[model samples]
Target: MNNKTDFKTAQQFLVDNPDIEVIEVLLIDLNGVHRGKWIPRHKLQSVFEGDMRIALTGVTPDIWGRDVPSLCAKTGDGDGICVPTVRTLKRLPWLSRPTAQMYMHLTHQGEPWGYDPRVVLGQLQQRFAERGLIAVVAPELEFMLLSSERDAEGIPQVPQTRINGRSKVGGQLYGTDIMHEFADVLHEMREACDSMDLRLDTLVKELAPGQYELNQHHLGDALQAADNAQMLKRVIKGVAQKHGYVATFMPKPFAHVDGNGFHTHISVLDENGKNIFDDGTERGSQALRHAVAGLAATMSDLMLVFAPHRNSYRRFAAGTHTPIAPTWGYENRDVALRIPVGDPQARRIEHRVAGADANPYLVLSAILAGVLYGLDNKLEATEPASGGSHEQCRELAGDWLAATRDFEESTFVSEYLGAPFHEAMCAVKHFEQDEFNRTITPFEYDAYLITS
Candidate 1:
C-alpha cells in the first residue's frame, strides 16, 4: 500500500478523473508477466501509504504457473511488499469504465528486492553512474495481430484488413496500403498511447502478414525506457482485444513467417551530455568498439536472457531476420550488433539479439553489463562482419536447453545479476525444461505412432 505522503500522483490523478471506477496495480515478474490485483476507487486511498503484499513465488512462476520449489518457494512460500511507482499511473481508455493502472516494485526487509528484474537493472545503472556515464536506450517491438476467431483446429489466423475485410495474402514489408487498412485500430492505438504517456514513435508494416513493429522514443533513463516498452505492449494487447482482434508478442507465432523481435538501440552519454559513442567518425568512437566487443564476448553466455522460452528459440532459424552470430557492422542488418545509419550526434548500437518475448528489464541489463565490461577491460572486437556474420563468428546457443546450460555456467551472469538471481533463474528454467520434455507433442505422435 502506498502511504499518503508518497501518493501525491495517485491523489492528483483521482482528483483529475473522478469517474474512475477501479485501479489496477501491477508487478512484473521474471518472465515478463504482469501480476496484480484490481481495487475499487474507494479503496485506492488506503493502498497508497500501505504495503501491498504478494506471494514471492508469483514472480518466479513458470509459463504454466507451476511452482519451482527451488526458487524462493521453499522458504516458507512468503510474501513481498509491492510498492507502487506513481509516475506509471495511467488510464485505460479501452475499458468500458474508467480504469487506472500503475506499476509496482517488489521489496523485502525494506531494501530493493534482489530477485526483481527492475532492481537488477537499477544496480547496473548505478555502476554506470559511478563512471560518470548514462545509458540512453530505445526498443523496437514487433508483434502480430490475429483474428479472435479460431480455425477448426483452434489455430490462430491473421485478422482481415479493415479496408478490404479480407486476410492479407502476401508479404507487404513497408506497405503503406497495409497501414491504411488497419487505420481504425492503429488510430485508437495512437490515441491510447497519448493518454498513457507511452512515447510511441513509429509503426511499420513488417515482412509477414499481420506483423508490425512499434518504436519508442529514446530516453536517457534506461529503466523508464523499459517501462515504456512494457506499457506499450499492454496498451497494444488491450486495444487490440477491444477492436475484436488478438495481439501476440510471441517470437515465432508462425513457423513459416518472420518472427517478432525486440531490438534495443543504445547510446552512452558522458557527464557533459555528449554522446560517448560518437567521436566525429562514421566508424564510431573507441568506446563504441569496446561496447561491441563486450556484447560479442557475452553473446553465448547470455543467450537465455535474449531468448528465454522454448518457442523463442524457433525465431533464430537461418535465413530469418534473426541474428546467427555475435558480430557487429555499420548499417548492416545481417549482424547482431548494428550501427544504424544516422546522424553522428545520434550514433548508437542497435542490439538485435533479443526476441520480443524477452523481458525488457533483463535484456537491457545484460546489454549494459556487457558494455560496461568491455569498457573496463578495453576489449577489442574482430574485423567488422560484412555482408554476413555466420562464417566469421561464433553462434549463440542453438537450443533452449543449451542456452540455459550456458547461462547457468556463466561467471559473468553471476557477477552482474547477483548470485541469488542467477541460481533462481536457472532453477526456474530447469523446471520449465523438465516439464516441457515430459509433455508429448503432436509431431512426436505423427512420426512415432505410425513408424514405431
Candidate 2:
C-alpha cells in the first residue's frame, strides 16, 4: 500500500470521480502542517508521473509557515518533485466543491528527500525490515471542539452542545450523553473516515469539557498507522468545521482542564507472524524489556519531538495524566511506557509521552528507532513501578528550549533519523524557539506592571 501511484491508478480515479474538479496535493512538513498546491483535476496525472514540483523548503518550514533561513540558504530554495502515495488518494467528503486530496513526499533528482518526515519514517521502516521485525502501531489522539466565535479577549469558547444549543461546563469523562450531544457531526466524521479507509475504532468523551479522544485500530505497518492518524485528524477538523464548530489538536488549550495527548500502542512481530514480545507469560519477554529500556534511555533526548511548542510544555504538569518521566510499569497510565494487561499474544507497550500536536511520522520513527536500539544493544529495563512512576524516574526536559537543545545535540537522533533530517529539525526548532523568546505575553505585563 506504500507504493507510489501509477498513471493507470490516477487515470482510473479521475474516471471514477469525474466530478472532482480540483485535487489537493499535500506535503506534510516538520511541524505536521500540510503545505501543498491545489491543482486542476487534469494535472493529477502529471503529479502521479512525478512532474509536479514544489519548493524544497516546503518540508522545512517553522511552525508559523516561515522558511528557516539556515535551510533555505543551504538549498538555495530549489524545487523538488512530488510523488503521490496511492493509498492516500481520496475524495474530500467535507468540502462543498467536488475535490480530492492525496499525500505526497518530495523527491530530488529521483531520490527520496531526506527532509521529508514520511521518508524519515520510511528509513526506520527499512531498518525494521532488515531485522526481520515488523512494528504494529495504533495511535489514540485527543482534541477539543470549540466554537468558531471568540470572547471579548479573543479567546476560544467551548462549543454549545447540539442537544439544546447551550454551553456545558466541567469534564464529562466517558459520558455517553455528551457523545450523543455531538452525534450528527461525529457521524459525518465517521463517514469521512470510512471514505478515507481510516480504521477509527472508538470515540470517548475525555476528562475536559468539549474534549474527546478517538482511537485507531492497530496496523501492521507503522507508516500506514501514521498515515491513518494524520488523515483522521484532517477528517475530524474538516467535519467539525462543516458542522459550525472548530476542532483543535492543541496540547493544552485551557489552563484549568486536562490537556490533549497522543498515546501510541506498539507491538512487534517476527517475520513468521509471531509476536516476539510475548513469551507465553503475563510479564512478557526480555525483548519487551529491551524496548522499554531503549525508550527510557532516549526519551529525554527526543523530548522535542514529543513536545514541540511552548504551550506543549504546559501539558506536562503533575497530576494531568501526562508522564513527566521515562518510567515504565504494568498497566500504569502515569508512566511513559506501559505494558497493557491483556492476553500475552496481544501484549504491547503503550507510549504516553507525545502531545496530540506532535507529528505522527516523527513520533513513530522515534519510537521504532528506540525499539531497534534496545533490541540491538540488549538493554535491560528498570524494575516496573507498581503504583506510580513519576517520582521513580528523572523528569523529561524542563522546557521547549532545553528540549530543543537536547534534540540538537543528540548523536542518537542524528544517527537514526539521518544527519540531514536531524539538522533540518534542529534548525526549524531553534528558529521557532528564538521567535518565542522574543515575545512578551499579557500575563507578564499584568503581573509586573508598576508592581516592582
Candidate 3:
C-alpha cells in the first residue's frame, strides 16, 4: 500500500473537510517530540506545492527544548524542507476548532535527515526489505489519567470519581467496572481514533488507580505502527484534556504504584506473505529463536532507548512487573522476551522492556535491528526462564547514566543506527543529564540545610 500523499490528495482532503480552518504539519524529532507549524486554511495548498521550510535544529532539541550547538543546528538554525506524509492526514475529532493534522519527514538537499525519528524507522524498515522480510509490530501503551487540578504540594492526583460517581481506587486490574468508570472518555478517544484511522485494539484497567492500557491493532508495516503509537499518544492527551483530565505516560508516576509500560509485539513475514516465525508446531520456528536471541543479546546495549528518562529506571524494582533481566520464555510475563501462546500462524515475540515514555521509533528500531543482527549472525538464545528471571540473570544498567554510557559506547548502535544519530542522541542525553545535575532538589536542600 504505497499511500504516499501528494498535493492532489491534500487538495482532496481539504475539499472533504471543508470546515477545517487550519492544518498542523508535525515532524517527530529524535527526542520523539512533535515539532511543526500551523498553516491557515487558505495557505494549506502551499504545503503540498513544495517542502515546508523549518529550522534544521527544530528536531534536535532536548526535553527542555535546548539545542545542541555541536550538531551545527545553530548555523543561523538553517532551514530544512519538510515534506508532508499523506497517510497521516486526518481530522482531530477531539479538538473544538476545525483543524487537521499530518505527519511529516524532514530532508536537507533531498536526503533524509538522520536525526528524524520517522526517518530512522524508515531506514530500519529498508534493511528488513533488503532481506526479503517485513516486520509486523504493535505497541501496547499504558498510561494514567489524573485530575487536572494538583494537590496543595502541586503533586498530581488521580480523579476521585469516574463519570459514574464511583470513587477511584487502586488495584483494579482487569475490572470491567473500572472501564465503565471512564466510558465517556474512552468512547470519545475511540471516536478520535476512528476518525484518524488509528487501529486501537483494546482498553483495559491497569493495576494503579486511574491507570489504563490501550493496545493498537497489529500493523504489518512496522513504521506505520510506530507512527500510530506516536499519534495515539497525542490523541489520548488531547482527548483527556478535553474531558477535564490530565493524561500522563510517565513510566513511574508514583513511588508506591506500578509504572506504565510500552510492551511491543512483533512477528516477521517473508516475501511470499507467509509467517516466518511459525513452523506449524508449539515451538516457534528457527527464525523466531534467532530473533529472540538477538533481542536478548542486545537488550543491555539498547536500554537507553527502552528506559530513556531518569525516572524510567524506577520501574525496574524487584516486585515490579517490569523485567529486571534479559530473558525469554513461552507466554511468560516475568521474562523480558515472551513468546505468547496463540494460534500458530499468529505467533510473535512480545518485547516487554520499553517504558511508555520512550520514543516509539527508537524502540522499534532497536528491536528490528536486534532481530536482523540475530538473523545475520544466527545467534542462539539461552534456556527459557521458568520463574522470575532475575536470579542469575544479566541485569540491565542500574541507572540512566549507565544506560546512556553503554549506548554511547556500543559499536552495534553506531553501526546499525548510523554514527550521526548515535552521536546526536548521546549528546542530547548527556546535555539533559548535565542540566538535571545543576538543579538542587528539595531533598538535597532539606537534607543539607539542617543536618550538614
Candidate 4:
C-alpha cells in the first residue's frame, strides 16, 4: 500500500469520510519491520497537522529486533513522522475495531533519506527514465504454512493452510481441490490487494506442506513495483493475524526442506517501446547475452542484496525451483537465471537469487543496475552451469561472509551501487554477522554439553 492515492488528496478523502476512525498507521523501518503507534480517529487531525511522531528505534537500528545498542535511540530513537502517504490508507479487515491502514515511506528531517532502500530504487527508476527505458518486474513469492503450535520435539511445526477437515491423499499438479482448504485466506488476500491497487494474477499451493504462492502482476513502474512487493508482505501478515494465523516472509523459516523465495522476472523496454531482450538474430542478440553475463558475473557480489540472511542460503537447493548456481539457461529450471517458456514478446530474465526476506527496492537496484552494466561493458555469458545443488554447493558461495567479501570486491557492483552505499550496507551486515558468529546455537549446545 505504498501509494494508493496522492498525499493531499488522501488526507482530504479522510476528512470527507468523517466516520473513518484511523486506528493505526504502518511504517516500514530501515530493517523492513512494520512499526507505529496507535491513534484515535479524532487524532487523525494531529496526523494531518504533522504532530505524529513515532519512536526512533524502529528506523535507526536494532540487532535481531532488540535495541542492543542505544546509538539510534540516543538520537531521538530515530523518530520520524508516520506522515500520511494517504493512498496507503485502507480498512484493516482483521482488527478488533474499525482499523484503517496506511504505510509511510521514511523521511529524515523532512528530506527523503538517502540510504533508504525504497528511495534508493526511486533514484534508480529516475535514472532509467532518463535513458528512455522502463523497467517492469514481477515476483513469484513462495512461503510455508506452519502449524500455529510447537511439536513434541519442541520444534515449531507446519500444517497445510487448510486440511479440508478430512484425511487426504497426494495430488501434485494444479490440484484445484486443495484450493477449497484455503479459499477464505485467498479471498481476503484478493480484497486487500485490490484495495491497495496491486494487481494479483494467481494463487496456488506450492511443493512443501502448508506452502502456498502468489504471482504478482507485471508492474508498470519499477519503484512502485518494489514498494508493492514490500507492501504485500505487510498486508499478508496483517490479514493472517485476523484468522489467528501468522504469516512471515522470512527466507528460511524452516531448518530443512525448501525455503521461501521471491523469484523475480524482469524486462527492459527501450525508447521505441520495444522489448530489448527480443533477439531473432539466431546467434542471440549481443545485448541480451551481455545482460546475462553481467548478472552471472556480479551475482556473488550482489548476494547480500539478494540473499541477505544466514538462513537465506538454505533455500538454494537443486531439486527445488530456487537456484544454487549463478548461471542462465533458455527455458530451463536448473540454472539460476531461467528464460521461462513464454511468448517471444514476453522474453526476459528470471532472477532466482533473492530470498523472500530481501528488500525489494535494494534487490531491484542491484539487478537493474547490473543489467545496465551488462549493456555498458558489452560482456558475454559463458557456458551453461553444471547441474548440482544443496549437496555440492560448488555453484553457490558457502556463507554470508563469503558473499559479502565477493560483493565488496566486485567492480561492476561498486560502479553501480557506489562503494559508500555498498560499504555502509556491509558495515551493518557485518555487525549482525559478528553477533551471530559469536553466539552458540541451540544445536551446538544439545550436541556438545555432554556428548563431546
Candidate 5:
C-alpha cells in the first residue's frame, strides 16, 4: 500500500500551514459520498499513531445522507475507526479559512468494513490481479455549473434552470474563451492537483453549456484508478468553489440538457505493460470483443450502479451519448458503448452508461466484475443488443417494490458484488424510493390543490 507522510510529515503540515485549524478525515461511503469528521490541528500529531473514529451510520446510509434505523448504529452511537489514508492528504482551497483534507478507509476491530465502497473495489482489484490481467482506467467526469445567487431567505437556487436555460447555450466544444470565467479556478484546480500529486491528463470544457470534463490517466491497477477517480472529484470540487461557483457531479441536475456522464475508458493490460485488447487480430483482438461482450451482457443488471436513482435515469434520454440500450457501435453516439475510432494502441471501450452521480468505486467494480465474468466464463459478444437497458426504467418494480429484480435475478451480479453488499444497496435504495414516493412535490399541489 502507498501511504505517504508519517507523523513527522503530518506535524510538518501543521507547522507549515499554521493558519489552518481544521482537518477533515474523510471516507467514501457505500454511496460514494465523502463522510468523515472534522478534527482540530492538535490531533494531527496522533494521526500516524492511530486511526480516526466516525459514526457507523456512514457505511450504510443512502445518498441523501439518510440511514435506515434498523440497519445502522443508533443516533449518537459510534462503531469503528478510519485509518487515515495518508496518501489522500489534500488542502482545501475553498474554505473561508485554510483547511486540509484526507480520504480514509473504514476498519472495524482491525478488519475491512463490510459496507465500505473502497473495500469492495479493493477486493475486486485483487481478483483481477490474480488473473494476471490489469485494468487501466481513465474516468471522464462531467458536471454542471450553477450561478450562486440565492433567494431572500438565504435558500440556494440555480439562476438559469429549465430546458434552453443553461442547456442550449450552444455546444462549445473546447471553447476556452467562453470558459474563461472558470479558467482561474480550473488553473487553481491544476495547482491543487499538482500539490497533492494527483495525475490527470487533460481538462476541457464539454459539449453542454457550463459543462466540463477532466480526464485522469492511470492504469495497470484497478484500485488506483478508482482512488484517482474518487480524488478527482474531491480536488475539482474544492478548487471550483474558489471561483465563487459550486461544482456538482449530479447526474442530471437540469431536465432539458445533456446531463453529466462519467465515461470510463478501460484497457486490459499485461504484466509486460502491453494491452491485451490489441493482439493484431482482424478488427482488434477477440479479448477486446469479449470484454465488451461481458459489459453488454450484464449492463442491465448493473443499472442500479450506473443509473442509481430516478433522476439519474433521466439522463439516458436520446441525443446525448448515454445509451438507453445495450448497443455497441464504432464511434457511434447512439450506442450504449461507443468504440472510439483511433489507433488500436489506444483502443478502449467507452462505457456510456454511468451517470456523473454514480460512485466511482462502484462503477469500476461493476465494470471489473463484468470483465472478470467474461474472462472466467469465456462469454462472447456475438449478438450485441441495441438499447439494451431501457427495460430497467420501464420495469421500475412499481415503486421500489422490485426495482432490483433484474440485478437480483442476475447471478452474475450476485457473484460480482457478492450477495450481502448487493442486498444492502438494494435495501437502502428501496428506502430512498419510499422517501421520494411519500413526498408531495410542488407540481402535485399546484395541479390538484385548487382544481381537485
Candidate 6:
C-alpha cells in the first residue's frame, strides 16, 4: 500500500481487467471532495508515468469547486504532476460502466505538494519515523441513508425500509431488526468494501432513524487508515445510490436527530513494537497522559480541521454524545479523548472531536501532530474527568469563523503543518465563510421577513 505507482503495474492492471474502459484518477481536495479526471483506459499508463498534469489549484478549491482567490493569485495557477497511489486502484462495482479508480496526489518537480492533505499526513508520518514511533489508527465513520427524493420544500426524507418499503422513522440504536430491514443495501456495501480491500469491521444502527456507523479495523499505517476512510465513504454513497437512496457523511444532516461523527482510535508503538502507552496497568503510562494533554491543549487550534463547515457546528450541542470541551477520561464516551477499557497491551486514545465530513487526511495529521507534540514535550495531562462533567474546561470554537481565526493565528499549526499549508487553509476557509455570510437562510426569512 505504498504511495508509489509504476507504469508496469498500470499496464498489468489494464491487461488483467481488459473490460475496464475508464480509469478515474481522483485527487482529494482540502475539503475532502473527490476531484479529478476520467481518463480512457489507454491513458492510465501516462498517469502512472507522471505525464498527467492538473492545476495545483485543484487541491485547494472551496467546497463549491471554485478557486480560492488568494491561492490562485499566489501560485499563478500552475500545473502539478499527478502520481497515483497504487493501492487504491480498484474496479467500480456500483457504476454501470466498467470503470476503475485510483487515488492520486499532486507533485511539482518530483517534490510533494504541501497543499495536498495526503502529503501533509505523509509528512507527519515521516516525523513519527524520525522519533522511531508508529501511530496505529482506526477510524469510525457515521452517516445517514435518506430517500433520494426530497420533500416538496426540498428537505431530505428518511429512506424507506427495504423489506416493507415503509418510511423509516425511529431511532434504533444497535437494533438488529433495523439492520435486517436494510440488509440488501448494507450487504452490497460490504461486498463493495471487500472488493476495494477496505478493512470494514462492524456496522451498527445509530441513534437516528436512518443513521448508521461503520468502524474500520485498526491499521498500523496512519496514512492508509485515512485512505480507507475516504474510500469507504465513496462505497457507502455509491452503494446507497444504486439502491435509490442518498448517503451523506454530512455531520448534522438532520437538526433534531444525532449528528455523524468521525471518531479515531489511536495508539503509538515504540521501535521495539511494544505499545508505548501501556505499562501493563489499567491506568496506562505517562506517555499516554502526555499525548492526552497535548491533544487537549491543541484541540481548539485544530477545530477547523474537526468542524470544517457552517453546518458542522450544528453537531456540537451539549449532551448529544458529542464532546464540547477538551476533556479526557477512562472509558468515558462523553469526553473529547477517551481511554478505552481494553487489554492494557492494546491501550489507545479515542479522539471524538472530528465530524464525519472532515477530511480524513487532515483529521489524522492534526491528531498525530498532537501526539508528537505531547511526546516531544513530555506534557502532563490534567486529572482524568469524572462523571462526564466538563464545566471547568474551555469549549472548542463554537462556529466556523472562530475556528478559522484560531487556525489562522496558531503558530503551532504553521510550525507543524508547514506555513504554506497554514496560509492556504486559512485563505480557503475565509473565502468559504465570506460566501456563507452573503447568503440569507430560509430561517432568516421566516424569523425576520415581516418583523422588521
Better of 5 and 6 by lDDT: 6
Give each model's whole-structure lDDT.
0.86, 0.89, 0.86, 0.69, 0.73, 0.90
What's the lDDT for residue 450 in model 1?
Answer: 91
Error of 1 at 250 (Å): 0.8
Q: How good is model 4 by TM-score?
A: 0.85
Could you tell me how far off, in angstroms, the CA of residue 195 lies in candidate 5 after the best superposition?
A: 2.2
Which residue pairs come into collision in candidate 3? none
lDDT of 3 at 44: 65
Q: Count the backbone clashes (under 3 Å) in each candidate.
A: 9, 0, 0, 8, 5, 0
**Candidate 5: segments with Cα more than 4 A from true spot:** 1-20, 73-78, 150-169, 383-403
List per-candidate RMSD values in Å.
1.9, 2.1, 2.3, 3.9, 4.0, 2.2
- Could you give candidate 4's per-residue lDDT for residues 376-443 as a string of tens digits? 78887887554544433556675788888887777766567765356446656777788888999888
Write one digit per residue (lDDT tens) for candidate 1, span 1-452: 43665577688888999999889988878898888899887777656665578877667888777778887546467887887778888898988988998888878778777677888888899999999999999999999988999898778898766544564556588988878877888889889999888888898988888998999999999888888888899889999999999999999987888899999999999999999999988888999999999999988889999999999999987777688789889998878999997788899999999999999999999999999999999999888877764454347888899999899999999897777678778988998999988999888999999999
lDDT of 1 at 225: 87
lDDT of 3 by residue, 66-147 (tens): 7877766434678788777787888888888999888888788888877777888889999999999999999999999989
Better of 3 and 5 by lDDT: 3
Tell me how far candidate 6 lies from the true structure as C-alpha RMSD in angstroms.
Answer: 2.2
Clashing pairs in 6: none
Question: Model 2: per-residue lDDT, tens digit, 1-452?
Answer: 23344667877888999999998899999989999999998887677666888988899999899999999999899999888887788898999999998999999988999999999999999999999999999999999999899899888899766543563556678888978878899889989898878998998889888999999999999988998899999999999999999999999988888899999999999999999899999999999999999999999889999998888999988777788888889988988999999899998999999999999999999999898889999999999977664364447986888898899889999898888889999999889988978998887898998696
- Candidate 5's residue-wise lDDT over 172-260, tens digit each? 77877766656677788878777767788898878776788888876666777777788778777776666677788887766776888
